[model samples]
Target: MNIDECESSPCQNDGTCLDKMNAYQCLCHKGVEGAMCEINRNECLSSPCKNNATCIDGYDHFSCVCLPGWEGELCDVNIDECFSHPCQNDATCVDGIDSHRCVCQPGVSGINCQQD
Candidate 1:
């Protein structure tokens, strides 16, 4: 009689064990790997976050948490600080990654170039 190799239940992590001639084969479940399905696949292994963002692992996916001055799914976009027209006195509003800068006209001052 042929010995049943799968009788010992060597597979792990809910894997299915199949008996072979003289060995056993383990069919791993989804999101798991290894000879015995002992390793759980890390959802955040690919580093999905961009621009110095944080990556959080989930059931079968990952979340990219944006950092300061960054936004979007992968945190690849820089925040547009000058979109609201913060500058005054006809000053030029320059958008930057961390903050916005106002290019004041001659004799103009203050954070938003409001003074003249």
Candidate 2:
């Protein structure tokens, strides 16, 4: 007697099974792999981020979120907040993490040396 492979629904993880000649084919889901769709693909396995950026894995995809003082698609670019010289009155501009600190001159105060 020819036993039907698809009768018992041997496919797992919501995979679809196609019966062939004395064999079967398992069509796995988006994030699933392997013969019976038993293995879940690891989205973070390739280390998609650069420059020490954090990688968040998702369904069949991943995201690279830059850390402080960094920006870009891969977080490989350094953000320079003081490039525009935000400090006024000759105040020193000290670049910080995702921000800048204005070292005001003598008798000067406030973030951009706007106040005494």
Candidate 3:
């Protein structure tokens, strides 16, 4: 007389339960694990986000909250402030970590080389 151990749906988080010899096993689904698949896998464990960006975990996925002067899916891109042409008066723009430098063409002045 074998009592069905899987009679009761004890598995959680969409886990598959396999009845064994007076025991049961739960096969966790994607992005989940634990005795009953109750734990959500931490996608941020690997630090996928770049440049001090915050990592948000999701169902089998992750997202990055980029800091100022950064962009892209993984926050890997350094925002080019020069893209908007902040440097006026025809200055050479040099990209930096999180900022841009305007090399004023001779006789030009001001923070953005806007002055003459």
Candidate 4:
């Protein structure tokens, strides 16, 4: 009959019962959610992320963000679609951000110093 007693009563796994003056409320935990916190909530239904970004769900909330080389929800894969040759035949190699530059010798035109 008492709210405190009800809250302590054994309900079910992942179920937290909150007793009120006239009624009771259940705060469901992971893998469980609903009016009484007795139903299971499917995370896939929400499609929380946008632009193909990944959606990582958390307690009572969720997170959506894109990964490197990918910029959409679900983290849809994409192609970098780029190439570079930084090393010269006579000179050394030099790496750069998103691209590479060649250190040509005294008389080199292309990377790897193939031409003069």
Clash pairs (backbone) in predicted model 3: none
Give lDDT tens digits, candidate 1, residues 24-97.
89999777889999887887788878988989876446789887899998999999999889999999999998
Supply candidate 1's per-residue lDDT for 31: 79
* lDDT, candidate 3, 30-85, per-residue tens: 99989888899999999999999999999778999999999999999998888888
**What ranges in model 3 sit over 4 Å off?**
none
The per-model lDDT (C-alpha) reads: 0.88, 0.86, 0.90, 0.59
Q: Please tell me which predicted candidate would have the highest TM-score against the true structure.
A: 3
TM-score of each: 0.69, 0.61, 0.83, 0.35
List candidate 2 stretches off by more than 4 Å.
71-73, 77-85, 89-116
Clash count, one per candidate: 0, 0, 0, 11
A best-first ranking of the candidates according to their lDDT comes to 3, 1, 2, 4
Off by over 4 Å in 4: 1-13, 21-23, 48-73, 81-116
Put down candidate 2 lDDT per residue, 1-31, tens digits, no spaces: 5567887888888999998877788999898
Query: What's the TM for model 2?
Result: 0.61
